[model samples]
Target: MTDLKVRKLPWEFDESVPFQWNRENPRFGIMMNAVSFLAPAFERFIVSSTRAAMAQITDPATLEEADAFLRQEAIHGRAHRNHTAALVKQYPGLKQVLVDLDASYDRVLKTEPLEYHLAYIADIEATFTPLFSVMLNHQDKLFDIGDHRVGPLFLWHFVEEIEHRSSAKIVYDAVVPSPWYRLRVIPKVVAHVMGCFSMFCRAVDTHVPAADRGIDACDMIVRPKRLTSLFERSELPGQFEGVPRTEVITMLYRLARAQAPNHSPATEKVPAFASEWFEAYEQGKDVVNWYRPARVAG
Candidate 1:
Protein backbone atom coordinates (compact mmCIF):
# COMPACT_ATOMS: atom_id res chain seq x y z
CA MET A 1 0.00 0.00 0.00
CA THR A 2 1.11 3.55 -0.67
CA ASP A 3 2.02 5.75 2.31
CA LEU A 4 -1.02 7.93 1.77
CA LYS A 5 -2.56 9.14 5.00
CA VAL A 6 -6.13 10.45 4.96
CA ARG A 7 -5.92 13.21 7.53
CA LYS A 8 -8.79 15.57 8.30
CA LEU A 9 -7.73 19.19 8.62
CA PRO A 10 -9.25 21.49 11.24
CA TRP A 11 -10.61 23.83 8.59
CA GLU A 12 -13.43 26.11 9.71
CA PHE A 13 -14.19 28.95 7.32
CA ASP A 14 -17.22 30.96 8.36
CA GLU A 15 -18.37 34.50 7.57
CA SER A 16 -14.95 36.05 8.15
CA VAL A 17 -12.97 34.48 5.31
CA PRO A 18 -12.39 37.17 2.75
CA PHE A 19 -12.70 36.72 -1.00
CA GLN A 20 -9.23 38.23 -1.19
CA TRP A 21 -7.78 35.86 1.36
CA ASN A 22 -4.21 36.49 0.37
CA ARG A 23 -4.03 40.13 1.30
CA GLU A 24 -0.48 40.46 0.05
CA ASN A 25 -1.30 38.89 -3.27
CA PRO A 26 -4.97 39.10 -4.11
CA ARG A 27 -4.43 37.98 -7.70
CA PHE A 28 -2.74 34.80 -6.56
CA GLY A 29 -5.53 34.24 -4.05
CA ILE A 30 -8.17 34.77 -6.73
CA MET A 31 -6.34 32.40 -9.08
CA MET A 32 -6.38 29.75 -6.38
CA ASN A 33 -10.02 30.57 -5.57
CA ALA A 34 -10.80 29.65 -9.15
CA VAL A 35 -9.26 26.31 -8.28
CA SER A 36 -11.59 26.08 -5.28
CA PHE A 37 -14.44 26.28 -7.80
CA LEU A 38 -12.92 23.48 -9.84
CA ALA A 39 -11.74 21.05 -7.13
CA PRO A 40 -15.05 19.63 -5.84
CA ALA A 41 -16.49 18.84 -9.28
CA PHE A 42 -13.20 17.55 -10.63
CA GLU A 43 -12.61 15.40 -7.59
CA ARG A 44 -16.06 13.89 -7.88
CA PHE A 45 -15.18 13.02 -11.46
CA ILE A 46 -12.01 11.43 -10.10
CA VAL A 47 -13.96 9.35 -7.61
CA SER A 48 -16.39 8.21 -10.27
CA SER A 49 -13.60 7.35 -12.72
CA THR A 50 -11.64 5.43 -10.12
CA ARG A 51 -14.73 3.49 -9.05
CA ALA A 52 -15.31 2.38 -12.65
CA ALA A 53 -11.65 1.52 -13.19
CA MET A 54 -11.43 -0.51 -9.95
CA ALA A 55 -13.26 -3.51 -11.44
CA GLN A 56 -10.62 -3.92 -14.13
CA ILE A 57 -7.61 -3.39 -11.81
CA THR A 58 -6.32 -6.86 -10.99
CA ASP A 59 -3.41 -5.96 -8.76
CA PRO A 60 -4.36 -5.81 -5.10
CA ALA A 61 -1.74 -3.19 -4.39
CA THR A 62 -2.99 -0.94 -7.17
CA LEU A 63 -6.50 -1.43 -5.85
CA GLU A 64 -5.38 -0.33 -2.41
CA GLU A 65 -3.74 2.74 -3.90
CA ALA A 66 -6.88 3.61 -5.82
CA ASP A 67 -9.00 3.26 -2.70
CA ALA A 68 -6.65 5.50 -0.74
CA PHE A 69 -6.56 8.00 -3.62
CA LEU A 70 -10.33 8.12 -3.75
CA ARG A 71 -10.59 8.64 0.00
CA GLN A 72 -8.07 11.44 -0.07
CA GLU A 73 -9.79 13.08 -3.02
CA ALA A 74 -13.17 12.76 -1.30
CA ILE A 75 -11.80 14.51 1.74
CA HIS A 76 -10.31 17.18 -0.51
CA GLY A 77 -13.64 17.71 -2.18
CA ARG A 78 -15.32 18.16 1.17
CA ALA A 79 -12.76 20.67 2.39
CA HIS A 80 -12.99 22.67 -0.83
CA ARG A 81 -16.76 22.54 -0.67
CA ASN A 82 -16.61 24.12 2.76
CA HIS A 83 -14.44 26.87 1.35
CA THR A 84 -16.57 27.36 -1.76
CA ALA A 85 -19.77 27.26 0.21
CA ALA A 86 -18.46 30.10 2.30
CA LEU A 87 -17.78 32.03 -0.91
CA VAL A 88 -21.19 31.30 -2.38
CA LYS A 89 -22.84 32.33 0.87
CA GLN A 90 -21.13 35.67 0.49
CA TYR A 91 -21.77 35.96 -3.26
CA PRO A 92 -24.95 34.12 -4.21
CA GLY A 93 -24.10 33.99 -7.92
CA LEU A 94 -21.21 31.68 -7.13
CA LYS A 95 -23.85 29.05 -6.41
CA GLN A 96 -24.69 29.02 -10.09
CA VAL A 97 -20.98 28.84 -10.89
CA LEU A 98 -20.83 25.64 -8.85
CA VAL A 99 -23.94 24.34 -10.63
CA ASP A 100 -22.47 25.08 -14.06
CA LEU A 101 -19.10 23.58 -13.14
CA ASP A 102 -20.75 20.40 -11.90
CA ALA A 103 -22.79 20.12 -15.08
CA SER A 104 -19.63 20.44 -17.18
CA TYR A 105 -17.97 17.54 -15.40
CA ASP A 106 -21.23 15.58 -15.29
CA ARG A 107 -21.33 15.78 -19.05
CA VAL A 108 -17.83 14.32 -19.23
CA LEU A 109 -18.65 11.55 -16.77
CA LYS A 110 -21.80 10.70 -18.68
CA THR A 111 -20.48 10.90 -22.24
CA GLU A 112 -16.82 9.89 -21.97
CA PRO A 113 -15.79 6.28 -21.73
CA LEU A 114 -14.18 4.99 -18.56
CA GLU A 115 -10.85 5.00 -20.33
CA TYR A 116 -11.24 8.63 -21.33
CA HIS A 117 -12.08 9.62 -17.77
CA LEU A 118 -9.03 7.73 -16.52
CA ALA A 119 -6.86 9.38 -19.14
CA TYR A 120 -8.22 12.80 -18.24
CA ILE A 121 -7.52 12.26 -14.54
CA ALA A 122 -4.07 10.83 -15.29
CA ASP A 123 -3.14 13.70 -17.59
CA ILE A 124 -4.09 16.35 -15.04
CA GLU A 125 -2.79 14.55 -11.94
CA ALA A 126 0.52 14.01 -13.73
CA THR A 127 1.24 17.73 -13.68
CA PHE A 128 0.45 18.43 -9.99
CA THR A 129 3.79 17.30 -8.56
CA PRO A 130 5.71 19.71 -10.73
CA LEU A 131 3.13 22.48 -10.85
CA PHE A 132 2.53 22.43 -7.11
CA SER A 133 6.21 22.01 -6.32
CA VAL A 134 6.69 25.53 -7.70
CA MET A 135 3.89 26.81 -5.50
CA LEU A 136 4.92 24.89 -2.37
CA ASN A 137 8.53 25.85 -2.81
CA HIS A 138 7.44 29.45 -2.80
CA GLN A 139 4.94 29.03 0.00
CA ASP A 140 6.28 31.96 1.92
CA LYS A 141 5.20 34.22 -0.90
CA LEU A 142 2.15 32.41 -2.24
CA PHE A 143 0.67 30.86 0.91
CA ASP A 144 2.33 31.99 4.11
CA ILE A 145 1.26 35.57 3.63
CA GLY A 146 -2.34 34.63 2.94
CA ASP A 147 -5.13 34.30 5.49
CA HIS A 148 -4.32 31.74 8.15
CA ARG A 149 -7.65 30.06 7.56
CA VAL A 150 -7.24 29.86 3.80
CA GLY A 151 -3.52 29.35 3.15
CA PRO A 152 -3.14 26.06 4.94
CA LEU A 153 -6.20 24.64 3.21
CA PHE A 154 -4.32 24.92 -0.08
CA LEU A 155 -1.02 23.90 1.50
CA TRP A 156 -2.58 20.72 2.86
CA HIS A 157 -4.22 20.00 -0.47
CA PHE A 158 -1.03 20.49 -2.49
CA VAL A 159 1.14 18.37 -0.19
CA GLU A 160 -1.38 15.54 -0.32
CA GLU A 161 -1.39 15.93 -4.08
CA ILE A 162 2.35 15.31 -4.02
CA GLU A 163 1.80 12.24 -1.87
CA HIS A 164 -0.65 10.67 -4.30
CA ARG A 165 1.08 11.82 -7.48
CA SER A 166 1.50 8.32 -8.81
CA SER A 167 -1.98 6.94 -8.04
CA ALA A 168 -3.80 8.16 -11.16
CA LYS A 169 -1.08 7.06 -13.58
CA ILE A 170 -0.91 3.68 -11.88
CA VAL A 171 -4.65 3.23 -12.36
CA TYR A 172 -4.42 4.47 -15.93
CA ASP A 173 -1.59 2.08 -16.74
CA ALA A 174 -3.47 -0.80 -15.19
CA VAL A 175 -6.57 -0.06 -17.27
CA VAL A 176 -5.41 1.53 -20.52
CA PRO A 177 -1.66 0.79 -20.48
CA SER A 178 -1.01 3.13 -23.37
CA PRO A 179 1.37 6.07 -22.93
CA TRP A 180 0.68 7.27 -26.47
CA TYR A 181 -3.02 7.28 -25.76
CA ARG A 182 -2.41 9.26 -22.58
CA LEU A 183 -0.35 11.79 -24.53
CA ARG A 184 -2.97 11.98 -27.26
CA VAL A 185 -5.60 12.90 -24.72
CA ILE A 186 -3.58 15.68 -23.09
CA PRO A 187 -4.80 18.46 -25.40
CA LYS A 188 -8.47 17.69 -24.80
CA VAL A 189 -7.93 17.42 -21.06
CA VAL A 190 -6.06 20.73 -20.98
CA ALA A 191 -8.76 22.45 -22.95
CA HIS A 192 -11.48 21.11 -20.69
CA VAL A 193 -9.74 22.09 -17.46
CA MET A 194 -8.79 25.52 -18.79
CA GLY A 195 -12.29 26.11 -20.00
CA CYS A 196 -13.61 25.36 -16.52
CA PHE A 197 -11.09 27.71 -14.98
CA SER A 198 -12.09 30.43 -17.46
CA MET A 199 -15.71 29.96 -16.56
CA PHE A 200 -14.88 30.32 -12.86
CA CYS A 201 -12.92 33.49 -13.49
CA ARG A 202 -15.69 35.01 -15.56
CA ALA A 203 -18.16 34.19 -12.83
CA VAL A 204 -15.93 35.84 -10.25
CA ASP A 205 -15.82 38.95 -12.41
CA THR A 206 -19.57 38.95 -12.70
CA HIS A 207 -20.33 38.25 -9.05
CA VAL A 208 -17.56 39.61 -6.84
CA PRO A 209 -17.11 43.36 -6.69
CA ALA A 210 -13.88 44.92 -8.00
CA ALA A 211 -12.93 46.31 -4.56
CA ASP A 212 -13.43 42.92 -2.97
CA ARG A 213 -11.17 40.98 -5.35
CA GLY A 214 -8.67 43.86 -5.77
CA ILE A 215 -7.57 42.64 -9.23
CA ASP A 216 -8.98 41.54 -12.52
CA ALA A 217 -10.50 38.14 -11.86
CA CYS A 218 -10.00 37.40 -15.55
CA ASP A 219 -6.29 38.22 -15.47
CA MET A 220 -5.34 34.62 -14.80
CA ILE A 221 -7.19 33.40 -17.90
CA VAL A 222 -5.17 35.51 -20.32
CA ARG A 223 -2.95 34.11 -23.08
CA PRO A 224 0.69 33.43 -22.33
CA LYS A 225 1.83 36.21 -24.66
CA ARG A 226 -0.46 38.68 -22.96
CA LEU A 227 0.77 37.53 -19.55
CA THR A 228 4.34 37.96 -20.68
CA SER A 229 3.60 41.40 -22.06
CA LEU A 230 2.00 42.36 -18.74
CA PHE A 231 5.03 41.04 -16.92
CA GLU A 232 7.36 43.04 -19.17
CA ARG A 233 5.33 46.19 -18.66
CA SER A 234 5.57 45.80 -14.86
CA GLU A 235 1.81 45.49 -14.58
CA LEU A 236 1.88 42.28 -12.58
CA PRO A 237 1.59 42.59 -8.80
CA GLY A 238 2.93 40.90 -5.65
CA GLN A 239 5.02 37.76 -6.07
CA PHE A 240 4.08 37.54 -9.74
CA GLU A 241 6.16 40.58 -10.51
CA GLY A 242 9.21 39.21 -8.75
CA VAL A 243 9.07 35.62 -10.01
CA PRO A 244 12.44 34.84 -11.51
CA ARG A 245 12.45 34.18 -15.26
CA THR A 246 14.61 31.13 -14.61
CA GLU A 247 12.14 29.82 -12.03
CA VAL A 248 9.30 30.18 -14.52
CA ILE A 249 11.35 28.48 -17.23
CA THR A 250 12.30 25.64 -14.90
CA MET A 251 8.67 25.19 -13.81
CA LEU A 252 7.56 25.08 -17.45
CA TYR A 253 10.27 22.53 -18.27
CA ARG A 254 9.28 20.33 -15.32
CA LEU A 255 5.60 20.57 -16.22
CA ALA A 256 6.39 19.42 -19.80
CA ARG A 257 8.61 16.64 -18.52
CA ALA A 258 5.85 15.47 -16.21
CA GLN A 259 3.59 14.70 -19.20
CA ALA A 260 6.20 12.75 -21.16
CA PRO A 261 5.26 9.15 -21.93
CA ASN A 262 7.96 7.61 -19.72
CA HIS A 263 7.61 10.13 -16.92
CA SER A 264 7.40 8.52 -13.48
CA PRO A 265 6.13 10.59 -10.58
CA ALA A 266 8.16 8.30 -8.35
CA THR A 267 11.36 9.84 -9.69
CA GLU A 268 10.25 13.44 -9.59
CA LYS A 269 11.99 15.69 -7.06
CA VAL A 270 9.59 16.59 -4.26
CA PRO A 271 9.75 19.97 -2.65
CA ALA A 272 11.45 20.01 0.76
CA PHE A 273 8.43 21.78 2.21
CA ALA A 274 6.23 18.78 1.46
CA SER A 275 8.31 16.62 3.73
CA GLU A 276 8.31 19.34 6.37
CA TRP A 277 4.56 19.71 6.13
CA PHE A 278 4.13 15.97 6.53
CA GLU A 279 6.40 15.95 9.54
CA ALA A 280 4.54 18.89 11.04
CA TYR A 281 1.25 17.13 10.57
CA GLU A 282 2.64 13.96 12.09
CA GLN A 283 3.82 15.99 15.09
CA GLY A 284 0.34 17.45 15.59
CA LYS A 285 1.18 20.91 14.45
CA ASP A 286 -1.81 23.07 13.56
CA VAL A 287 -1.55 22.88 9.80
CA VAL A 288 -4.87 24.63 9.32
CA ASN A 289 -3.31 27.78 10.69
CA TRP A 290 0.20 27.10 9.48
CA TYR A 291 1.44 30.66 9.34
CA ARG A 292 0.34 31.71 12.79
CA PRO A 293 3.22 31.35 15.23
CA ALA A 294 1.14 30.02 18.09
CA ARG A 295 -0.62 27.41 16.00
CA VAL A 296 2.48 26.24 14.15
CA ALA A 297 4.66 26.05 17.26
CA GLY A 298 5.41 22.43 18.02
Candidate 2:
Protein backbone atom coordinates (compact mmCIF):
# COMPACT_ATOMS: atom_id res chain seq x y z
CA MET A 1 0.00 0.00 0.00
CA THR A 2 2.80 2.42 0.88
CA ASP A 3 5.29 1.33 -1.83
CA LEU A 4 8.02 0.43 0.63
CA LYS A 5 9.92 -2.03 -1.54
CA VAL A 6 13.47 -0.76 -1.52
CA ARG A 7 14.66 -0.21 -5.09
CA LYS A 8 18.39 -0.27 -5.61
CA LEU A 9 18.90 1.84 -2.53
CA PRO A 10 22.50 1.93 -1.37
CA TRP A 11 23.33 -0.42 1.45
CA GLU A 12 21.96 0.97 4.72
CA PHE A 13 23.72 4.30 5.40
CA ASP A 14 27.27 3.68 4.20
CA GLU A 15 29.63 6.26 5.60
CA SER A 16 32.77 5.23 3.72
CA VAL A 17 31.99 6.72 0.30
CA PRO A 18 30.26 9.92 1.36
CA PHE A 19 32.83 10.48 4.04
CA GLN A 20 35.75 9.86 1.68
CA TRP A 21 34.01 11.86 -1.00
CA ASN A 22 33.73 14.74 1.45
CA ARG A 23 37.45 14.82 2.19
CA GLU A 24 38.27 14.70 -1.52
CA ASN A 25 35.52 16.91 -2.88
CA PRO A 26 35.77 20.19 -1.04
CA ARG A 27 32.79 21.95 -2.62
CA PHE A 28 30.36 19.07 -2.32
CA GLY A 29 31.83 18.15 1.04
CA ILE A 30 31.06 21.48 2.66
CA MET A 31 27.62 21.69 1.10
CA MET A 32 26.71 18.25 2.39
CA ASN A 33 28.23 19.03 5.75
CA ALA A 34 25.96 22.04 6.03
CA VAL A 35 23.06 19.81 5.12
CA SER A 36 23.87 17.62 8.12
CA PHE A 37 24.54 20.66 10.23
CA LEU A 38 21.21 22.34 9.63
CA ALA A 39 19.33 19.06 9.35
CA PRO A 40 19.25 18.34 13.05
CA ALA A 41 18.21 21.91 13.48
CA PHE A 42 15.08 21.91 11.33
CA GLU A 43 14.64 18.43 9.88
CA ARG A 44 15.32 16.46 13.06
CA PHE A 45 12.47 18.38 14.59
CA ILE A 46 10.22 17.56 11.66
CA VAL A 47 11.15 13.88 11.50
CA SER A 48 10.75 13.34 15.23
CA SER A 49 7.59 15.40 15.35
CA THR A 50 6.29 13.69 12.24
CA ARG A 51 7.01 10.29 13.71
CA ALA A 52 5.05 11.16 16.85
CA ALA A 53 2.22 12.93 15.08
CA MET A 54 1.93 9.99 12.69
CA ALA A 55 0.97 7.63 15.51
CA GLN A 56 -2.45 9.26 15.67
CA ILE A 57 -3.14 8.44 12.02
CA THR A 58 -5.76 5.68 11.72
CA ASP A 59 -5.36 4.51 8.15
CA PRO A 60 -3.30 1.37 8.37
CA ALA A 61 -1.64 1.89 5.00
CA THR A 62 -0.83 5.53 5.69
CA LEU A 63 0.55 4.70 9.10
CA GLU A 64 2.84 2.17 7.50
CA GLU A 65 3.91 4.74 4.92
CA ALA A 66 4.69 7.26 7.62
CA ASP A 67 6.87 4.70 9.33
CA ALA A 68 8.68 4.20 6.05
CA PHE A 69 9.02 7.92 5.69
CA LEU A 70 10.55 8.01 9.13
CA ARG A 71 12.97 5.31 8.11
CA GLN A 72 13.93 7.05 4.89
CA GLU A 73 14.41 10.43 6.54
CA ALA A 74 16.39 8.90 9.36
CA ILE A 75 18.69 7.28 6.83
CA HIS A 76 19.19 10.56 5.05
CA GLY A 77 19.89 12.33 8.31
CA ARG A 78 22.42 9.71 9.30
CA ALA A 79 24.29 9.82 6.01
CA HIS A 80 24.59 13.55 6.40
CA ARG A 81 25.55 13.17 10.05
CA ASN A 82 28.36 10.78 9.25
CA HIS A 83 29.47 13.14 6.54
CA THR A 84 29.66 15.92 9.14
CA ALA A 85 31.49 13.73 11.58
CA ALA A 86 34.08 13.16 8.90
CA LEU A 87 34.35 16.92 8.59
CA VAL A 88 34.70 17.36 12.35
CA LYS A 89 37.56 14.88 12.49
CA GLN A 90 39.38 17.12 10.04
CA TYR A 91 38.24 20.47 11.39
CA PRO A 92 36.88 20.77 14.90
CA GLY A 93 35.55 24.28 14.09
CA LEU A 94 32.70 22.83 12.01
CA LYS A 95 30.67 21.53 14.95
CA GLN A 96 29.72 25.00 16.09
CA VAL A 97 27.60 25.58 13.02
CA LEU A 98 25.37 22.62 13.77
CA VAL A 99 25.19 23.53 17.42
CA ASP A 100 24.21 27.12 16.73
CA LEU A 101 21.73 26.29 13.99
CA ASP A 102 20.00 23.59 16.01
CA ALA A 103 19.62 25.83 19.01
CA SER A 104 18.19 28.71 16.98
CA TYR A 105 15.84 26.72 14.77
CA ASP A 106 14.59 24.63 17.67
CA ARG A 107 13.89 27.74 19.67
CA VAL A 108 11.78 29.05 16.82
CA LEU A 109 9.88 25.85 16.12
CA LYS A 110 9.36 25.15 19.80
CA THR A 111 7.42 28.36 20.27
CA GLU A 112 4.87 27.32 17.68
CA PRO A 113 2.09 24.87 18.42
CA LEU A 114 1.25 21.72 16.50
CA GLU A 115 -0.55 23.79 13.90
CA TYR A 116 2.63 25.58 12.91
CA HIS A 117 4.49 22.32 12.43
CA LEU A 118 1.61 20.90 10.44
CA ALA A 119 1.28 24.00 8.34
CA TYR A 120 5.02 24.12 7.65
CA ILE A 121 4.92 20.52 6.50
CA ALA A 122 1.88 21.11 4.33
CA ASP A 123 3.54 24.00 2.57
CA ILE A 124 6.89 22.23 2.12
CA GLU A 125 5.33 19.09 0.68
CA ALA A 126 3.18 21.11 -1.65
CA THR A 127 6.21 22.97 -2.91
CA PHE A 128 8.29 19.80 -3.31
CA THR A 129 5.83 17.54 -5.15
CA PRO A 130 5.61 19.24 -8.51
CA LEU A 131 9.32 20.07 -8.60
CA PHE A 132 10.64 16.51 -8.20
CA SER A 133 7.83 14.88 -10.17
CA VAL A 134 8.62 16.95 -13.23
CA MET A 135 12.30 16.00 -13.29
CA LEU A 136 11.61 12.33 -12.60
CA ASN A 137 9.45 12.50 -15.71
CA HIS A 138 12.10 14.10 -17.87
CA GLN A 139 15.22 12.00 -17.48
CA ASP A 140 17.12 12.48 -20.71
CA LYS A 141 17.96 16.08 -20.01
CA LEU A 142 20.42 15.07 -17.33
CA PHE A 143 23.64 17.06 -17.58
CA ASP A 144 27.16 15.87 -17.06
CA ILE A 145 27.33 14.41 -13.54
CA GLY A 146 31.15 13.91 -13.47
CA ASP A 147 30.98 11.38 -10.65
CA HIS A 148 29.04 8.14 -10.98
CA ARG A 149 27.95 7.48 -7.42
CA VAL A 150 26.58 10.85 -6.35
CA GLY A 151 24.65 11.51 -9.56
CA PRO A 152 22.48 8.41 -9.36
CA LEU A 153 22.05 8.89 -5.66
CA PHE A 154 20.67 12.34 -6.46
CA LEU A 155 18.18 10.96 -8.95
CA TRP A 156 17.08 8.10 -6.70
CA HIS A 157 16.37 10.43 -3.81
CA PHE A 158 14.64 12.75 -6.25
CA VAL A 159 12.26 10.03 -7.40
CA GLU A 160 11.40 8.97 -3.88
CA GLU A 161 10.79 12.59 -2.95
CA ILE A 162 8.26 12.78 -5.75
CA GLU A 163 6.62 9.59 -4.60
CA HIS A 164 6.15 10.70 -1.01
CA ARG A 165 5.73 14.46 -1.51
CA SER A 166 1.98 14.34 -1.19
CA SER A 167 1.97 12.24 1.97
CA ALA A 168 2.98 14.96 4.40
CA LYS A 169 0.63 17.55 2.96
CA ILE A 170 -2.14 14.99 2.95
CA VAL A 171 -1.49 14.36 6.62
CA TYR A 172 -1.15 17.96 7.69
CA ASP A 173 -3.91 19.40 5.56
CA ALA A 174 -6.29 16.92 7.16
CA VAL A 175 -5.94 18.75 10.45
CA VAL A 176 -5.30 22.31 9.26
CA PRO A 177 -8.40 22.35 7.02
CA SER A 178 -8.06 25.79 5.53
CA PRO A 179 -7.89 26.93 1.93
CA TRP A 180 -5.80 29.76 3.32
CA TYR A 181 -3.27 27.16 4.34
CA ARG A 182 -2.39 26.77 0.66
CA LEU A 183 -1.79 30.47 0.16
CA ARG A 184 0.06 30.68 3.45
CA VAL A 185 2.71 28.51 1.84
CA ILE A 186 4.20 31.57 0.17
CA PRO A 187 6.19 32.53 3.25
CA LYS A 188 7.34 28.99 3.79
CA VAL A 189 8.97 29.29 0.38
CA VAL A 190 11.38 31.61 2.08
CA ALA A 191 12.84 28.67 3.94
CA HIS A 192 14.50 27.35 0.79
CA VAL A 193 15.77 30.76 -0.23
CA MET A 194 16.89 31.78 3.22
CA GLY A 195 17.84 28.42 4.62
CA CYS A 196 20.09 27.54 1.67
CA PHE A 197 22.03 30.77 1.86
CA SER A 198 22.44 30.59 5.61
CA MET A 199 23.49 26.97 5.63
CA PHE A 200 25.84 27.19 2.65
CA CYS A 201 27.58 30.36 3.81
CA ARG A 202 28.19 28.89 7.22
CA ALA A 203 29.59 25.70 5.78
CA VAL A 204 31.82 27.53 3.33
CA ASP A 205 33.24 29.63 6.10
CA THR A 206 33.95 26.61 8.22
CA HIS A 207 35.47 24.43 5.50
CA VAL A 208 36.65 26.38 2.48
CA PRO A 209 40.31 27.41 2.38
CA ALA A 210 41.17 31.10 2.76
CA ALA A 211 42.15 31.42 -0.92
CA ASP A 212 39.35 29.45 -2.64
CA ARG A 213 36.80 30.54 -0.07
CA GLY A 214 35.45 32.81 -2.79
CA ILE A 215 34.09 29.78 -4.62
CA ASP A 216 30.53 28.78 -3.80
CA ALA A 217 30.05 25.55 -1.87
CA CYS A 218 27.54 23.70 -4.01
CA ASP A 219 28.76 24.92 -7.41
CA MET A 220 30.36 21.66 -8.57
CA ILE A 221 27.18 19.60 -8.16
CA VAL A 222 24.83 22.47 -8.97
CA ARG A 223 26.14 24.33 -11.99
CA PRO A 224 24.91 27.89 -12.11
CA LYS A 225 23.19 27.78 -15.53
CA ARG A 226 21.43 24.55 -14.62
CA LEU A 227 20.24 26.03 -11.37
CA THR A 228 18.46 28.71 -13.35
CA SER A 229 17.03 26.09 -15.70
CA LEU A 230 15.73 24.18 -12.70
CA PHE A 231 13.68 27.12 -11.50
CA GLU A 232 12.17 27.94 -14.88
CA ARG A 233 11.92 24.48 -16.43
CA SER A 234 10.41 22.48 -13.58
CA GLU A 235 7.11 24.09 -14.53
CA LEU A 236 5.83 23.50 -11.03
CA PRO A 237 3.34 26.26 -11.58
CA GLY A 238 1.83 23.93 -14.17
CA GLN A 239 0.33 21.84 -11.38
CA PHE A 240 -1.68 24.94 -10.73
CA GLU A 241 -1.81 25.12 -14.54
CA GLY A 242 -5.50 24.70 -15.39
CA VAL A 243 -6.58 23.95 -11.86
CA PRO A 244 -4.41 23.54 -8.77
CA ARG A 245 -2.68 20.23 -7.99
CA THR A 246 -3.29 21.04 -4.38
CA GLU A 247 -6.98 21.15 -5.16
CA VAL A 248 -6.82 17.61 -6.50
CA ILE A 249 -4.24 16.42 -3.95
CA THR A 250 -6.60 17.49 -1.21
CA MET A 251 -8.65 14.49 -2.30
CA LEU A 252 -6.42 12.37 -0.06
CA TYR A 253 -8.53 13.63 2.82
CA ARG A 254 -11.80 13.44 0.96
CA LEU A 255 -11.01 9.78 0.27
CA ALA A 256 -11.72 9.17 3.92
CA ARG A 257 -14.90 11.24 4.05
CA ALA A 258 -16.29 9.44 0.99
CA GLN A 259 -14.97 6.06 2.11
CA ALA A 260 -12.95 5.60 -1.04
CA PRO A 261 -11.43 2.33 -2.12
CA ASN A 262 -8.62 1.05 0.06
CA HIS A 263 -5.07 1.69 -1.07
CA SER A 264 -3.19 -1.40 -2.27
CA PRO A 265 0.04 -2.10 -4.12
CA ALA A 266 -2.14 -3.88 -6.59
CA THR A 267 -3.54 -0.48 -7.36
CA GLU A 268 -0.48 1.62 -6.49
CA LYS A 269 2.57 -0.36 -7.52
CA VAL A 270 6.06 0.46 -8.88
CA PRO A 271 7.98 -0.97 -11.78
CA ALA A 272 11.59 -2.06 -11.30
CA PHE A 273 13.24 1.13 -12.33
CA ALA A 274 15.86 -0.45 -10.17
CA SER A 275 17.87 -1.16 -13.28
CA GLU A 276 19.20 1.68 -15.47
CA TRP A 277 16.26 4.09 -15.31
CA PHE A 278 16.54 5.00 -11.65
CA GLU A 279 20.04 6.28 -12.22
CA ALA A 280 18.80 8.83 -14.76
CA TYR A 281 15.16 7.68 -14.91
CA GLU A 282 14.05 5.89 -18.05
CA GLN A 283 10.81 7.41 -19.25
CA GLY A 284 8.51 4.39 -19.10
CA LYS A 285 9.95 2.42 -16.20
CA ASP A 286 10.65 5.40 -13.97
CA VAL A 287 7.90 7.49 -12.50
CA VAL A 288 6.22 9.38 -15.31
CA ASN A 289 7.92 12.63 -14.25
CA TRP A 290 4.43 14.08 -13.81
CA TYR A 291 5.24 16.51 -16.62
CA ARG A 292 8.34 18.78 -14.51
CA PRO A 293 13.62 21.19 -13.08
CA ALA A 294 15.67 19.20 -11.50
CA ARG A 295 18.17 20.23 -8.45
CA VAL A 296 19.78 20.08 -4.60
CA ALA A 297 22.66 20.46 -2.13
CA GLY A 298 23.90 18.56 0.88
Q: Write the per-residue lDDT of candidate 2 for residues 1-298, one digit (tens) a residue.
A: 6765344343232333343232233443344344456554556666866776776678777777667766666665554565456556665666776776767657656776666676665555444444443333433333122123333444555556556655665556445556465455546545543564565565656564644433455442344466443224232222122223454354334322222112221232232333344445434432322222233222
lDDT scores of the candidates, listed in order? 0.87, 0.48
**Residue-pair clashes per candidate, as listed?**
0, 5
Clashing pairs in 2: 134-292, 137-289, 234-293, 238-241, 277-281
Model 2, CA-based lDDT: 0.48
Worst 10-residue lDDT window, candidate 2? 257-266
State candidate 1's TM-score: 0.95
Model 1 lDDT, residue 70, Cα: 97
Which candidate has the highest TM-score of all? 1
Per-residue alpha-carbon lDDT of model 1 for 144-243, expressed as tens digits?
6778888889999999999999999999999996777988988899899889998998999999999888887787786756756533534546445356
